[model samples]
Target chain A: MKKLFFYTTLALFFSACNKEEKQNYSNIAIYGHGGAGFESHTNRLPANSFKSIQKAIEVLNADGVEVDLQIDSNGTTWLFHDQFLEGKTSGNDCFGERSTSYIKTCNYNLGGKIFQLQELMDYFSSLSPKPKVSLQVELLDRCIDHSLLIEQLIAIMEVNNAYDWVQIESDSPGLLIQLKAASKHFQTFIRAPDLTSCINLCSENGFDGIIMNNTDVSVKDVERVQALGFKIALFGVASQAEIKSALKKHPNQIQCDNIELLHRIMKQ
Target chain B: MINKGTAFILSLFLFISCPTFGQDSLSSNIKITTHFGYEISNVGCYGNIGGQINYKKFGFGLAYILDYSDANGLDGPFGVATTLSFSPNHSDNKVINHFINLDYRITFHQRFCTFDCSQKYNKIQELNIGYGLSIKIFKRLSISNTINIGWYLEKSLSDRTGKTISESGSNSLINAKLNYLIAK
Candidate 1:
């Protein structure tokens, strides 16, 4: 009995140490969330910065990046995530309330220059193999004319020849409708609140895809969405477990916070 | 200002020089040990200081663990652990001592946000049961390795938006400890 117990414990130990079987993830596209992700502690650079975006594409070799875009007073699109610049940057007031010149002067508290969306597109245009980019348009300030903002953004993409590689995502259905109506070539996605809403919104609005939080949907829900002939993208993945869970669902894309961790797991 | 490494070294030296009390027998002697180890878990590596009282093959210990990771700056998930251990074979002459332990730990997870400059804290309680193998390297020093499967009883977090999210999951931890016996 003692010998049996010892062997059983040893067998358990070995089983625990063994690695799990690796699954093929070639079909899944991995995109960085706000560039290389937005962890306050782990991230070396500020989120949505040019440097962060560059690192995610160049260093991490991600399939693409999902960046937050907010238009300034002069209708120039800038990369930012916050509604108000008070906490994230040295400047006060809403990001949309500031002008191009005033916004340029405002630096991120984490030490980086505020860059324009045109600059990013210009850079992408210069690359030999342009990386895929997803612009998450934030319609926070109701004062800014949405039509003008959309026009400016569309123009920038057209001028830079970025339409082929760029995809647009937004929570506002009105903005998405306007964008889709403006150009059918543009791949527009709706950021849904939940799985049920995600499927309903995508089917109803005829969006190219639906983006939902990884935790909000199950594997069956992801399959259900895909079975309806709509692409599904999952985000809000930070840890290894979250990444694995998201990958198991086999979504079309994943906007991960820890791109390096996801890459490591993919390699395994 | 002593860093954690320096403080551990200082404590090691102090423990090494401390006088032994009572008999040197395994059953009668109480052992105070300081363990420095790396943990392979989401919570990251940890440094532990603990004391144990043994009676024959059975032992009980209380340890304070400080978990830290350099990959994500100074994110800390410190914990307090209580372990009940049983040695299958306990002999001073044996070079290898194998034991099984059941540990209950309460860890405080903390994350500091740069956006709002806010500190988010949460409590996670888990039970880990596993086996360990310790090799006696010196007269009063041993090197040990343990692998545990932990089941979280309760784990909840408040994200950057201050939304409370509860998750249920299980994780495994592998730890290697350089244990120094202060009293035996």
Candidate 2:
């Protein structure tokens, strides 16, 4: 019993540290995941928040920020990415399906406050025109009422006068097309499912740009898409080496978990 | 790489069983051992069922760990699976035995992840050399405890958004396992 207790204690001791893995730094201008915050994965800083976005711009100097948007049953859209709040937050599995009032009470570690979409848009619109931070928002199809989601989304963007600053991206072609049809002024970027589709979608005239996963398409593909006269962004880069490889494409934007390290590497 | 890995394993087996060649006092026994244990560095808890063929002072072991379930009872641990073991039973003493365990595990980890909420297991192969003590509680039933110095090789496909990627790394850990043995 003593030995078992000792081993368990030792295991707990190691777990409590939960040290963030170190990556070799590089200099790169990219989209910051959850706003370039540290200790956020296990809920130190909430991803897709006002504070995280500000941190991304001021601290990491990210040119643009990508945030995830999901709606609750109360028709209130939130700045959360995952299908389940339990994934990163200290919330339970069914937390995603719960009412907004219940969600507001739950604590998400260091992601202290949850900001809804209208408020986030209001905050950004309040900012002055100088040194404006580009915003790329991804829609979570599963989290909201499917039929009314796009309608409500368009309403908020139009109301906040955020059309010029926002570039919306999603894997759902239906949503992308719907957003384009609903608001001709708003920028819509199609998140191509693969390289073939990336080329195919970029070839079409509707989208302002194409976003591809770093692993799916290479530098050559990026060049091909750019030749078709479409802007390109590469996301889902988890390491410094991946950032280095993706930078070879010279993409218009790249999403990275460690932008500070990337900038440092670039400075070197 | 697969061929080279297979070759190394074959060589290891031949080396482990070399001492029993042409020996007559060697006895053959079959053992089933269940291992319910946890791995450190937040690797999670795992349950393993091992089969071994004992010949005199040596035994070759194979174990399958069930770690894929979403619900793992109490702690809900996400652990790793699959291992190979070699037991060098005591020829000099009756109280203890020496062991060299070669483990091939699909380790589900957050550390070596792509930062996505959903994660998959990466391949981890480890070799642990340790000493074990066995207590025969009843007929055909015994319990054993082993403490090992482990060296591991990690090679697996990454959870990529667009394409699958191969990743590799290495680490060392100190581990212990408590196993319940049923023999025939």
Clashing pairs in 1: none
lDDT of 1 by residue, A1-268 (tens): 5744554455455445435698899899889898878845435467899867865665556778899888878888888888788888899897777888999999988678887888888777766567788899867677566777889987887777676789899888888888777777778888867777767777787788998999999999989989999888898898878998999999999999877567656655
Q: Give the worst 10-residue stretch by lDDT in candidate 1 chain A.
A: A9-18
Best by DockQ: 1
Per-residue lDDT over A1-268 for candidate 2, one digit per residue giving the tens place of the 0 to 100 score = 5744554455555444434445433333367775653332221346776656655554345655677777677777777766777756666554346788877875655546666777767665654431233344444445457666677788887887777777787777777778778878878778757767755664563877787788888778878877878788888775667766776778877777766445534443
Instruction: Estimate how well candidate 1 is docked, as a DockQ score.
Output: 0.04
| Candidate 2 ranges beyond 4 A from true positions | A1-29, A37-43, A93-96, A129-143, B1-184
Per-candidate DockQ versus the true complex? 0.04, 0.02
Error of 1 at B38 (Å): 6.0
TM-score of chain A of 1: 0.90
